[model samples]
Target: MASSNMNIPSGYVSSASSPDWLNKGDNAWQMTAATVVALQSVPGLVILYGSIVKKKWAVNSAFMALYAFAAVWLCWVTWAFNMSFGEKLLPFWGKAKPALGQKFLIRQAELPATAHYHKGGSVVETAMSEPFFPMATMVYFQCVFAAITLILLAGSLLGRMNIRAWMLFVPLWLTFSYTVGCFSVWGGGFLFQWGVIDFCGGYVIHLSSGVAGFTAAYWVGPRSSKDRERFPPNNVLMTLTGAGLLWIGWAGFNGGGPYAANVVSSMAVLNTNICAATSLLVWTCLDVIFFKKPSVIGAVQGMITGLVCITPGAGLVQGWASIVMGILSGSIPWYTMMVVHKRSALLQKVDDTLGVIHTHAVAGFLGAALTGLFAEPTLCNLFLPVTNSRGGFYGGVGGYQFVKQIVGALFIIGWNVVATTIICLVIRLFVPLRMPEEELTIGDDAVHGEEAYALWGDGEKYDITKHGWLSDETNHDNNKVPSGVTQMV
Candidate 1:
């Protein structure tokens, strides 16, 4: 019996299915977390984008997000995954390599660049993050994060970007922009080594997407003048459905950061919900007071901001601090979108369709900054490689930690801006970043040869004459469809 079992790993219980190094619970949880996060991209944001834009542009907007999710997966496994979590290539990047081999997949997951050593006068602290799960689990978990960032960026370019250009943009941006940010922040690049607190992805995913999305919107230009003036949600109820998924699915988004079903994950999940609820309430109150009526769209924005703000410190701060962060998240982003954006010429010039700059960029920066203030020392010890790390609120070396967080956010923002611009410019050399005038005017039907809804005239696409819709030909000589149909479109 002993001779027959010679090849089994040491401490192997009995069956090959149960390896000593593999913690089944942790592996299962990680996979489950990854799936929910993936859902946030596919059906979550996909539904949101599909229903939130002008009806004519629904199919194109959803397709952009769907295409990005699929494209990121392939690129992630082939090379981008390693460039994010493999050996260091530069201070802010990792070496590119394929992560598809079975030998590599079955091995225990370890972020080599995440190893750290600290010497405080007479004491030394050293640690490395080695999750008790196969590398496949880690790869899939990280891939979802990458995919969602690209999909989020699509929000800003929604009604007008060329599908062909966007298809190309996804893989290239994943390669040049997203990988660098992922490597630097979460994959143990310079920011991680410097002890910048990004407990989840305040800087990596939210901030990066917000900045890149805004920048891409600038390069791609605005939507049709008519659409921009009158764009309204095709279905607010469906938008809420997607928003609910995003809110619930975030349990896994932040929870999975620790790579285990442990205390930290539980804490993260709780904090996530607390912050989101607080922010939603605060946002609703503001809308009632300002507009004299609560706006569901505004409430969703608040929920998103709260979620983004808590992500960087979800497991590292107390629940009270989450409420504090939530209050600010609800207010600050609301002000930016409602007041500051209107006053700023630069903000007005960029047609960020979903206001990602306000919801993600501003909120993400606020969260990262707050994390530097509220991150508890004991909690930091549990997850951070840098020992003795604490937020500014805890005193001692906490001040330095806060500064590190801001610096980290700046690096991510600057990198995404430059990389996204370069990517857009490069793609423009081959294909137009914005669709031609006709496509912008016609929306999805012109771009994709399909429409999201066919409610008029024997299931045919919208038509003024065939559908017998009335129009004021004298008032708008060029207008084809009736005013009621225009609203529906």
Candidate 2:
């Protein structure tokens, strides 16, 4: 524990004062974690989405991520946060209320009561998860998780969804879908009471986003035939840049879930990196062996799988266990994407722009189940408030705990499928789910009246006819064409 009297850095901290209930170290770390998590969506996914799509769809792809982040914030504070973590309204949800009111925001952060369970659905006692920080810190931290989940879902629906429908989808899904998972798993609802161990949101965020993204992709329809056949990233370097942010930003993600700057947090940070690095290597090795060449995109996919896989048990598993999860995450998702997806008729029908289903949904489920299998008893005791929670390998109640994880995952999958489908159907009544053919063909230029690139001279839009050296030069060399215009090669 950091001493209360620790020297404060000058000018960096706005005020020297802190309340008795607050630990300056915890509060500082919490706020820092929140900011980095926010980075994963803004510049992180934003850049990745923009650069990975075809040049024409770049702006629209990036805007979807940006819009979801902004819209979630408004919904989060107004009522979504409380619906996720406030007082219980049902076994799987919390009551909705504004989190911005000073009376709620200024108080010490409090977690909902989770009931302990033994084998066969027996409850031990209810435990409250109280953190030493102001309510505002908790709200900010949780909101980022909510925001990123929506942004990730946008990955599948990218390239073709109507923007107006997407704007409406975010708030409704946040309110109806995300909140239910948030409350049920982490907010001390029935799943928590039943001894499910999601150290972070393996099921809540990754699985939910992946499943929902795929569902939305089905309803919104595939990208244009041209795009589906040969869509190459407009900027691989920029995609790498965004992938790097998401990789590093995860330090704050797994570390901050403990809501403390403690031993578990340190272990989580180490395990997260270990799993990601190992998974990346495994994926690269497989690619080299089979394809005779390594792919940067494949490497990024491995990195993501590792991250999502470790999330559920980051603080609840040992270092060695993380490596096991990593190796499997890397291989399993790779096979699914490379082999299973190609062979399956169902998978062929849906055009998931970025393969989010493989990276997020499959890898997420793999991680969740592996967490149940390998969760260290000592570590689980440290991270989970439930007295005897442990993974399957630990024996006795451990096997039962693993089963609980599977059950929890099923609930999440079912809910997201129903919720996402309903949300899409509702939005379609007001607006078309798919963009018009003109907009689909023209991409960013048709939708936003802007293009991502201006390779033409003087920053003008490219015009094959007008800007062609032979076409215009022959006619316009008579002082009609611009002075510097040149012929196409």
Q: What is the per-residue lDDT of model 2 for residues 1-489, given as tens digits with 9 covering 90 to 100?
A: 456436756433445246667787899999999999999999999999999998878999999999999999999999998888888899899999899888788788996545444532655554577788889999999999999999999999889999999989999999999999999999878887777888878999999999999999999999989889888898999999999999999999999999999999999999999999989999999999999999999999999999999999999899999999999999999999999999999899998889999999998899999999998888877878677778889898888888899999999999999999999999999999999987887787678866677545443443445654442122112212355664221
- What are the lDDT figures for the candidates, one per model? 0.90, 0.88
Off by over 4 Å in 1: 1-14, 119-124, 461-479, 482-487
lDDT of 1 by residue, 265-299 (tens): 99999999999999999999999999999999999
In model 1, the clashing pairs are none
Look at candidate 2 and give me any clashing residue pairs.
469-487
TM-score of each: 0.93, 0.92
Runs in model 2 deviating more than 4 A are 1-17, 115-126, 465-489
For each candidate, C-alpha RMSD in Å? 4.1, 5.1
Score residue 121 of candidate 1 by CA lDDT: 29
Model 1 C-alpha RMSD vs. true structure (Å) is 4.1
The lowest-lDDT stretch of 10 consecutive residues in candidate 1 is 470-479
